[model samples]
Target: MKDPNKAKTERMMVKRTLKNLELNRMAACYVETKEDALKLVRQIIPDGVKTASGGSQTLVQCGIIDFLKEHTKYFDRYDKTLSPEGRKQNEREAYFADFYLTSANALTEHGEIYQVDGASNRISALAYGPDKVIIVAGINKIVPNLRAAVERVKRHAAPANAIRLASGRFCENTGVCISPCFDENDLMCHADCGDDTICCNTLIMKKQRIKDRITVIIVGEELGY
Candidate 1:
């Protein structure tokens, strides 16, 4: 094997290159570790912000849900877990939110944010709707550019995410193409059909008019696998 130190140095160079590209391209940026992400969330919550989030298992793993539940007076929890009154409270708050916590697929050092969604709500909220959008990501999710971001999702995130979203054999298989059972009703495939298709055509935040509305928090620790 090559020198372990050299291998580490090369990886650092790749991250630095991607970061530079994002900067030159004018994307919003912040760097943090898992602890930093938590710290930042604590600070932002005190200023009083309402947030809406998709079902991101990674955020759950990061203890984000726990943080929000304990710290914020108002939050947009998924309707499934809330009481009817809490559900109404969430919707009412989302209507006039000035800031939000969101997640992204990749943060190019050149300053662009990339994300993919099945329902488009995550991308939509991050791109145009929220007055201020904060994207929290782990270092592992960083990539050189849009192309690399897609590949990262395909080779790694898609397969794992599909399994997490579904169950059984589908989780064991690693294929980039959308499954034939693109919908659950199709008996030939699992419930995860059509998932890859959704991830393939991601929303590029650089193309949005509300690009300024987005902010990024890049954690130094490996996160969101």
Candidate 2:
């Protein structure tokens, strides 16, 4: 069974995070399960709308990818039949999609979305492009502050994602960033992963000019790396 006290504490944290996210001019909500998350996503995105997503395990875990494929005009960049050029074309087209879906590397309780990327297409689209952006992340992705958010990505997200993508990056073999140690001065947290580093681009989303254009769904269950 789950610990009731821990669950209560998490609920409080999610509440605070949601408040801050709204204060930052972004929409935020919490769901108790992945099923609820999927349902909320469906409600936010109507059927047959043009949709695309960043490469996110969270979306897969929540069945959002399959839902998009079945219900929306989804641009599948991962389609096996697509040649390199075709995949590139699909990725470019995703910028103009009606809805863009992604998961954050880290979401701060102070209401910031932090993401690290390789090709940077994901961050680019999240920053601007899609008419609406939906971020589905688990409570495990939340942190106390920006500093902790950065640490979470370096210590956990980067290494795990490297293994997933089989990018042959240093973090994949090391199970952590090349330099995991960080002080206040090391907020940028640069790692020496060489030329093929997946952490090439980093994005920190704070206050948004476009209110509610980005909606964040924070699942109570741990869903992704």
Candidate 3:
């Protein structure tokens, strides 16, 4: 395997690049395991705060969901234990939460966060509503730049997510993003994927108009799609 130190150093460079763009930032942190990430997450999130989360394999992998549910007043719509109506109520409450936690589809070295959503609740919270947004990204999610960021989502993140969500798209079966050539203005596919598209909404977190609003955590371990 590649040296773990080298991997973390790369993520740090991306974190620094993000800070240079003047988005609120904390120094990139490297933890050895998922348990360590969970500890870090628990420490960062204050007790009794109203928190909510977007769907993230990373969150589950790092043991954040259980921790948040137990400690913080977290609105989790993904809980299978909740009734359908209850889940919808949770999702609606999440929009007004004090903190919103999520993982990035791709975080570019040039300081941009690229994400795709089916229903867009997550992206909407990231763009504007929440009092605080914490984006937890594993080193693997870092890309070279914006183009690579988009490519990362389409080629890797989206396909995995489609299968996980049981979206019944071509990519779910073929495990490919099925890119089609479109104009400069259009980044989404108009190809065979049609109505079953998972790339329904795209959000690019660029220069932050509000300082200290979004904080990104760069975890050393590989954690998500």
Candidate 4:
């Protein structure tokens, strides 16, 4: 069972985040569980549409990946059967997809989405491609501000993802970013993970000119990195 006080505080935080997201021209909602998140996704995206996704454990946990596979023409970049070139083709083609689904590395209470990427396909798509971008993140992803969001990724998200991907990066062994410490004025890319670092690209999504183009669903449960 959840602690009542914690749950209440989380609810207030979610409410604040949603309000700010709307002000930024992004649609936002809160779900109590991963199942609810998946259900909400289904309602937003219809069947037979072309869909794609950034590699995300949150989507897998919510069964959104499998859902897309069954209901939509999903571009499966993770299909091992596909050659490297084929996978690249799919990544490029995802720009035209009707919907793109992914999870943010961190979300600021200020209503900003922060994502760090290695291949950068995901960040690129979030920035420009697809008719709609759906981000499903857990409450644990929420932070006080952009600085806290960056610290969360460096201390938690990046290291965990590095281990999961077996990227053989420095953070994979160290269990933290190469340069984890940063101040409010520091650049988001203030890291020294070397040439093979997955933190090659960083994106901080703030106000959007395209109203409602991006929808964020924040789950109450702890999920993903």
State TM-scores per candidate. 0.70, 0.96, 0.87, 0.96
Question: What does candidate 1's lDDT look like per residue over 53-166, in tens digits?
Answer: 655655665677677666554455564779988765664555356666766666664556667666455665565565766667777777766667666665566666766666
For residue 145, model 2's alpha carbon misses the true position, in angstroms, by: 0.8
**Full-model lDDT for every candidate:** 0.59, 0.90, 0.78, 0.91
Model 1 residue 155 distance off true place after TM-score fit, in angstroms: 1.5
Which residue pairs collide, candidate 2?
none
State which candidate, 1 or 4, has the greater lDDT.
4
lDDT of 2 by residue, 71-156 (tens): 99999987999999998888999999999999999999999999988888899999988979999999999999887887898899
Q: What is the lDDT of residue 85 in candidate 4?
A: 96
The superposed Cα distance between candidate 4 and the true structure at residue 131, in angstroms, equals 1.5
Question: Candidate 3, TM-score vs. the true structure?
Answer: 0.87
Residue 40's lDDT in candidate 3: 82
lDDT of 1: 0.59
**Cα lDDT, model 4, residue 41:** 95
Clashing pairs in 4: none
lDDT tens readout by residue for model 3, 1-225: 668898677756755755653542423344656787788888888889999999999988888988889999999888789998898788778889988989999877777788888878789888877888878888788777777777777778888988888858877877767773333555766456668687888898877777668877777668799
Candidate order (TM-score): 4, 2, 3, 1
Candidate 1 least-lDDT 10 residues:
180-189
The candidate with the higher TM-score, 1 or 3, is: 3
